[model samples]
Target: MRNILVTGGAGFIGSNLVRELQVRHPEARIVVVDDFRSGDFRNLRGFRGDFVTADVSRLDWNAQFRDEIFDAIFHEASITDTTVHDPYLQAHDNIEGFRRLLRFAEPHQTPVVYASSAATYGICSGVQEESQPAAPANIYAFSKVQLDNLARDHARRFPAWRIVGLRYFNVYGPAESHKKAAASMIYQLYLQMKAGRRPRVFRAGEHCRDFVYVKDVVAMTLQALNAPRSDIFNCGSGQAVSFNEVIAILNRHLGTRLEPEYIDNPYAFYQPHTQADMSRARAELGFTPRFTPATGIPDYLGSLSPS
Candidate 1:
């Protein structure tokens, strides 16, 4: 890729991807576009590229781009807050924003690698796969499902366009502190432990999720660029780890014996388990997660300390 545009480049995954792209493709001209709603400027530290401050949902791409052409568009901009109940706002930003990006890519025939969500699969008994029907439980999840369907149609009409949608599970790692409440439990738990308070867990901490590290996610995203055709794939470690195990790992890393405080879950739409079936990603995108909870947690903790 030569000239590239990364929407939401200030966000967690997007910023990480942008950094890697800079290192791997030093000759490419990269531009980052973000409204800075949930994205933090600190995440873009040491970034050397153009940046556009505007909402992708309503930006006039024709006016903005003028004669510039992008080789690829990384569409990561979205309303990712799962607790937001306003349908109009969610649809406007996530669904409509994606449509705008897709339209911008149509004329250039640029490839798109966008972020999808594991929330698309609600209450799945087994590992979540792309073939299964989406059962989104919240507006955020619903927004992703709409985007996935739209991508499918876009691919059907534009047969040669390369579009890859990645359904990411619980992604946690560096540069996610800006996510605030939307940040992963790993950060939240770390904060609790740092304060000398016990890490809180809902129920018996038996709830399981395939929490993939950010580095692995960035690798899978870059690999998706090579996908020959349009398709959606799961981005996760393929191994299910319980909340209790996470706490245990944190305790080991911090050298503490802090016990977790179990509490009741208030949200009715909670998913007790989520495991990604990596068969499709491996066979198609050549994705294989290198970090398990044991390996990833310590690395994340280490990064938090000073050099």
Candidate 2:
């Protein structure tokens, strides 16, 4: 059986990936570890697998994971919430979590496929690629960038192991049922419009992102683990779309003519543009994102309804 260890499996994309892998690979024994922090536990309500609720940093891997060696590690645990005030705490959990996981993986020589961020390419003008030097704007972005750098150097030393750092763009899709503060824009916007409450738009919504679907990201990540060489790849939809276009697509799905209400931008922290150059991912991992907001929002939103 293919033994897969998924960190942060209770979160949005992680939870979805857990479900997908379980269904596809029945013989696989999936171990999910999330501290019940950013990711909701309810996300794994019907999940059938080995559920170990432990902080990724505090995990006793040597004892708990002694009998078995992991085939792959989905390193998704990190500090992503923007409302955080203490930068020190964020670094400890987000940055240090991977540091510990790395130490664990290195000894076992397990292939670790981790979630890197597009935020690593902050304030850049050209298409964001793996070659671009990471310049993080916020503390959260900084932690993710730090993790990517660690992976880069780690892979260089351990050429025999598969260490993939996937720089994920604006990822959004199903299984995100948390509040406004927890879920993505698409999910929150759907809830707003459905409840007859107008969703507010900020800064004329000109900023663009390579909004990749969760399913596509998972597929590419799995492919990365099986790859022969260790590398970092931009896992994102090749097409860039504005935030306004995202809301427009959601409106069509709800069958409502509700237009977005422009509001004064409150959160000053944001990346103006985060488009990706998926050329490397395509060439290396044969990764290509299959979902656009227009085509995907409807179904993804529909799946997250209050049942």
Candidate 3:
């Protein structure tokens, strides 16, 4: 049986990835590591796998799993909140945590597929390609840029090992309610409209983002395990959708015509536009996002309906 380790397996994308892993690799021995800082136990409700609750940055990996050899390590733990301004906290947790994981996996030369955020692009306009230089706008994104740098250096030192980094765009789907404020705009908007309140957005709601579905993100993540070479790829729906379009879609699905309540922009670090350039992902990872807001929103909403 395959042995797999998923850090942050109790969080949004992590939880979805964990459940999907169970269905795809039922016989695999999956061990989840999470600190529950931003992760919630409810996200792992039906998960039937060994779980270790500890901060990956501070955990003593060798002492905890002395003889275990993992077939793959999916490193998803990170300070994902973009609004967080504390440099030391974000850098320590995000960068050092990944560093420790790399050290643990180094001796075994384990194949690692870790999460890299599109936030590294910052306010860069046009299509976001992997080759473009990183322009991190906030401390959270800066930490991810450091992660890619670390991954590159590690891959150089250990050429035989596979270390694939996926730069995920805005992802949303089921099992994300636990994220609350950090959740995707789609989920936040749905909640407002569901409660008969006007959906809120930055003034005019013209900002655009590549809102890829979590299922697609998980699919691409799984595909990275088989990557032939160590590299980074952008994971997002190739198309961009505007915030105004999202409100329209939500209104149509919920059968409510609630107009959006425009508000002043609060965050100076907010990116005005983000659209992934998926040409590389298609050629390399054979990944093409299967859902756009037009289709994904309804599916996500239906899943939230008391089933």
Better of 2 and 3 by lDDT: 3
CA RMSD (A), model 1:
1.0
Models sorted by TM-score, best on top: 1, 3, 2
Q: Model 3 — which ten-residue stretch has the worst lDDT?
A: 265-274
TM-score per candidate: 0.98, 0.94, 0.98
Candidate 1: Cα lDDT at 85? 95
lDDT string, candidate 1, 1-307, tens digits: 8898999999999999999999999989999999999999999998989999999999998899988889888888887777789999987789999998898889977899999999888767568888999998778889999989999999999999998999999999999999999999988998899788999999999999899999999999989989979999999989999999999999998988999999999977567788999999999887799998899989999888644
TM-score of 3: 0.98
Judge candidate 2 against the unseen true structure and give its global Cα lDDT, from 0 to 1.
0.80
**Residue 192 in model 1: shift from native, Å?**
0.5
How many steric clashes between backbone atoms does each model show?
A: 0, 0, 0
Stretches off by above 4 angstroms in model 3 are: 267-269
Structure candidate 3, residue pairs in collision = none
lDDT of 3 by residue, 1-307 (tens): 3899999999999999999999999999999999999899999988989999999999999999998999999999987777789999999999999999999999999999999999888887778999999988889989999999999999999989999999999999998888889999999999999999999999989999999999999999999988889999999998899999999999998999999999999777566788999999899878788999999999998899854
In the order shown, the candidates' Cα RMSDs to the true structure are 1.0, 1.9, 1.1
